[model samples]
Target: MLIKRVPSAEAPLDLLLEADPSIDTIKRYLESSICHVATIEGETVGAHVIQPIGDGVYELMNIAVAPAYQGKGIGTKLLEHAVNMSRKLGAQRLELGTGTFGYQLAFYQRAGFRVISVERDHFLTHYDEPIYENGIQHKDRLLLALEF
Candidate 1:
């Protein structure tokens, strides 16, 4: 698999939507974010988006792997690449928002990110549709950060 930076316009929207459900939100961030794609045999299989939020901080806007390629460490590779890229770009820290509970929360924790705060009712207020996992609705957003 190969992971490399690509123009935001060239990012795989379908794959990205696997993580972020709102197309409007994705497009809003994509306008200023740097996108990276993971491909194998010329087929795009995973992707991540990172945006600078000023003061040497960056936000991991989205990360996703194709369903067929899930559980194969593709997401991990993409995340690691994002971290490395942020370091190279002089980022003081990397931050992201995710559901308060889920595999995704644990995934970032395993990668050294720690919970910073919680945005109550973030999903409820921001997203038009309710987000669910394991049959439970996601109502809060946990802000996590990895300090450089």
Candidate 2:
């Protein structure tokens, strides 16, 4: 797979967000952040977006892989690409949030991210509609960060 910065409109990212409903937020992030897509066999299979939040830090706004392509390490490649890009852009750290209970937390952990904090009632208090997957509503957001 090859990773590159591509126009969000040009990437097949809808497939990524549909895999996890809360990731729907990614659409808005894509509109304004530095975005990238992963291509395999010339087809977009994954995407990531990074947004600057000042203090020399960037927020990992989104990272998603096509459902059919989830286990092939495409997300990891996309993340590594984002990290390298952040360093190139002179970012001192990267931060992101994910549901308190999900594979996503572990995925970021495996990528060398460490838990920095938690928003105790983020999803429950911030979202108007309960964002759920597999019939479970997400209630908290665990913040994770990595130093560049």
lDDT of 1 by residue, 83-133 (tens): 999999999999999998999999999999999999999999999999999
Q: Cα lDDT for residue 130, model 1?
A: 95
TM-score of each: 0.99, 0.87
lDDT of 2 at 141: 91
Clashes per candidate (backbone, < 3 Å): 0, 0
Q: What lDDT does candidate 1 reach at residue 128?
A: 100
For model 2, residues 70-102, the per-residue Cα lDDT tens digits are: 888888888998898888888999998888877
| Residue pairs in candidate 2 whose N, alpha carbon or C atoms collide under 3 angstroms | none
Q: For all the candidates, what are their Cα RMSDs to the real structure? A: 0.5, 2.2
Query: Which regions of candidate 2 deviate over 4 angstroms?
Result: 9-13, 19-24, 133-135
Q: After superposition, how far is residue 29 of candidate 2 from its true place, in Å?
A: 2.3
Q: 45 in model 2: Cα distance from truth in Å?
A: 0.4
